[model samples]
Target: MKKIGYLILIICFLSCESETIETTTVNEELTAQQKTVTTNKNEAVVIRFIAGLSEAEKSVLRTHYGVTAYEKCSCGDENLESWNLEAIHEGATIEERVSSMEEEPEMEGADFNFDIQIASQVPTDVISGPIHYQNVLPKIRSQKASVTVGVLDTGIDPTYFRFQQPFLHNTVLDEETCGNDFFGWNFIENNNMPIDDNGHGTIVSYMIYEQLVNTATDFQILPAKAFDTDGKSTLFRIGCGLSYLIKKEVNIINMSFGWTTTSSAIIGSYIKEAEHNILMVTSAGNTGENNDEIAHFPSSYPARNILAVTAVDGEIPPTLVPILSNFGPISVDVAVHGIGLPFYTTAETAPTSVTGSSYASAKAAGFAASKYQEGTAMAVFYHKILLDKIQSSTLLQIKYASYLDL
Candidate 1:
């Protein structure tokens, strides 16, 4: 078993929303395949329990170790078998906590920012044009069950005109709007309203919403506002957001954010728990680094259900993505057109653009939702579908998998 991957990790495991308008055509044509852990002023330490912690261990952690401000990550009704915790460590350093923790029942895993924001600010290109819509209609119509996609990013702009369509009304709430139910839970503000204060979730959701809207009308997006206004998040918040999604039992989940760490075992465990139930899509990350060489959490977590996406631009599958995009035959599964695409959200009067693997992952989630069947090993089955569709090309940029151009 892997030990704690410490904050400056060589670790992994780990782990958005939008609106509608003219229906941004994300994948018009074929394409070639493709944050930081920070400390808070409060100095809280993050831990993941492989098995729920026993009362005795908790007592030990608090009494002897000077751990305080304990908080357990909770899902709505779904009790997660494996759980994550946040507590204020009184130790001088994380290394001190670990060294002194020698006698504790084998620390499963711990870290500060297991999963941080996937930097989406690198501008690859600015798209401006007449705004052409390509995916005129959804792909699958008469499916057995309607698909619900979990958007794990900043809260979505629920008021977006496209998201307000009658079809998505029930999905927006996910549950009954008792007093003031919103799209999904907000881990940041501790409220039901996960409305997007930052534009990242809005844009990410726009790509997904446009794709799903074009493909099928029965789809719904369950937005869990994981990131705050600064596009940053902590492990506890991310775990909580994921827990909410898992409890909601969505068909597919789009994780547009991730951090780089070789020691992301804690986050990986949470995702590992969810892999059996939901199909997950994540960004391959920016920084123009090779994911094959470096470690990018969730994307590089080596899970079957998680599909890591990289960005591309335009109609034909590009030989290479923008300089900011990360690619790897091993870590990344597919590539999509998430860059240079003009998108309009409720926050924007005109089409706007930004660069990140977040958009590409959203497109993949939307596409997967369009193709998702009711009863199946969704993660494995959909994963195979994407991998099989991979165009057999050179292993230059897209080393193993092919670029997805639909």
Candidate 2:
């Protein structure tokens, strides 16, 4: 089958208490383009292929296209390549980039095509009803655990009011900045600290901290920037960031970003680290596709007992699942509130509402970390308390229907 390229389009969130965030659409077509430009003798230039290429084509691409990195499809088959330029030329001719070969790659395994599905809406009237917090927070707060939760995403704003305390550490910068102090390290720039070009990371950090504050629980929040403001980062940078966390042996790791394919080396290293008993929670992705068809990677990688969470909109009655959330047996471990949730902003000035599986993954991370202090494996803790609640609730519903039939 033809390899598919996935793109994510995000809509901004309004005020923290806002009921719903608007949705946006992504382009459906995939095409390749090339441009020729004048080059200065001292300036270096790079050519990137907008689509996948073959190994022989890559060799030809290197000779003609001058790109630093070629974009490769993560579907196990290598089909695309990009080129970087070392020098610019005014006389350089831009050629149309395309694959001469037309044969489609073979699809192995199951012919599963997973699409994003919207679940029932959550009831807003019972917003004050008994939530998981009512049952778990009290026990956790009383213990005053020193558990640390790591957020791996866009860099956070340290000065955000919700994370102003000393408990918040920016692992990317190897420095501790308060909620009122915002500093970040940009892996793209090879900086010492993180900076929030995109507000998403800061928002996610705020959500986790807010949960801790609301629960009166004492836990540390470690901010790790895996993506930059442009919503992009190199696979090497991500691998390095995770390596840092593994070295620290933190209690929980929250990852909200993923691509179509994963690096086996990087994933294997993480699995080895997980063997040390650290818990990982990831976003199932917002592709709005079934897990079998286009599930996000890293979250979809074959790992034992990882928590892959889907997003749900809380503004709608009955807490319906977010339409963009990718789901399948292999993709989603559970669902959590992602939209219309209150969280802190990059300015740390006030709280705001934001939507995305990023927040859902954060919530899961915070919840799991809180329970870890109770001496439970992160996966086991969530499975026993949280997953059990969901499974049992479903079972109860089925039993009630059978009883009525009898």
Candidate 3:
């Protein structure tokens, strides 16, 4: 009887091991195939699934479908047995499958919304015209002439025509490998060179340079790479990136990335650093949710040295705020053009249009840099100039050109 029991246990162990090995092989194969199949390169797919599965059940599902990563809910609960369906179905049409799945009653309230859209069209005349500089540049140009504004977001496309003569100092790349000290680096590629694989950083860079700097008169940019292709980053990596920028003593730092909340210690450190006369500019996020209810870190931190900005659309008049712009009486300090903003693409020849609070933050940073002056007094001076501009504008006026028509 004992020998019979031992034999049954041995059989179960071997069966489990076989399943594990099979699952590993399947995952490896799927990952290799996913790399080759591309769809909606601009959008990232995150899968969500129902929870409350036993260990055996999860293993069975993973082995059966070869699942590798589990997507988490906004509440931080892990949804086991989920997969990036887009990746899993690579090369094959899964729209029918997705449609059928959506029809199921179990998924009625469990469905995830992937509604983020990147703007594709911008006013060519506005982008090509020199009116931006003629109207806005002279007021703040002399103040920012010598200030170093660091952009901590996606890496910049150095070859872009608009930035052909940008005052860039890269903090991402390691000096030993790139041979140049100021070129940006990418931690994702494990290299010193930080060229943008995604166009988000490039677009943000141009908005700051072309609109703010070119208009302001004489301000330069310091490019700092932070987020990668997926538009995801952690507080630790952000801290490391900021440390590099601090060492450079940049006059202004623009950050377009943030989570609902971040470590208090990290936030405090940033404030302390800002007190040293470095102005920090950040986005108010794009969720369109109430920031007071769900405070975003870095931006939410109450620091006198930091300025939190929200987005506005350029299609509106200069005095009105953009409809999509996030606002809070306390959290957001000001608003700027955040939608359908023109910027250069990775192609290096012509410009592409994109939008987000990321662009708004860059605009604010560039505007501040353009008016930057040495000493704490100068820092306060530039901040006031920007704040005054925001208060003078109204929402309706911000989205229409008629306000500027006069």
* Predicted structure with the largest lDDT when compared to the true one: 1
Q: What are the root-mean-square deviations of the candidates from the true structure over C-alphas?
A: 11.4, 15.6, 18.8
Per-residue lDDT for 1-406 in model 2, tens only?
0011000100111122233212111111211111111111222212222234545655664555344444332211222212334343234433222121111122111111111111211111101111221121112121223677777666654543445455554232323222121122344444434444455566666667766766676687655565654455544455545655654556777777766542233344454546546677777676565655554656776665467776655532213343565566545667676766654232323334555666787777766665565456645665553533343232121111110000
- Candidate 3 lDDT over 1-406, as tens digits, reads 4345334534543454423100000010111100101112222222223345565754564444333444332111233112444444434433444444444332211122121222212222211211111121112122224567777765655554456554554222222222323344454343444455445566667777865646655556655565665454443345545655665667778887665532234335545746657888877676654556667656777776677776665654443243445566667776676665544333333443555666777777777766666775745664464544633436422211111110
Q: Model 3 compared with the native: what TM-score?
A: 0.56
**Tens digit of lDDT per residue, candidate 1, span 1-406?**
1122121111111111122222112222222222323234235555554356676765665555555446654333222222223333453555566445433454556654443654775222222212111111121122223778888887765444555343222322334332333346777776655666665676677777777778764677777887876677876787778867776788788888766644445567667877776888888886677877877777888777887888776555454554667888788877777666665533345644565677778888878877777777755567555754557453257645466663
Would you list the rank order by lDDT, best first?
1, 3, 2
On a 0 to 100 scale, what is the lDDT of residue 97 in model 3? 41
TM-score winner between candidates 1 and 3:
1
Instruction: List ranges where model 3 is wrong by over 4 Å.
Output: 1-145, 170-180, 315-323, 344-352, 376-379, 387-406
Best-performing candidate as measured by TM-score: 1
Q: In model 1, which range of ten residues has the least summed lDDT?
A: 8-17
Give the local distance difference test score of model 2: 0.46
Flag regions of model 2 displaced more than 4 Å.
1-145, 170-186, 261-263, 315-322, 344-352, 374-379, 382-388, 391-406
TM-score, structure 1 vs. true: 0.73
* CA lDDT, every model vs. true structure: 0.60, 0.46, 0.49
* Every model's TM-score: 0.73, 0.55, 0.56
In order of TM-score, best first, we have 1, 3, 2
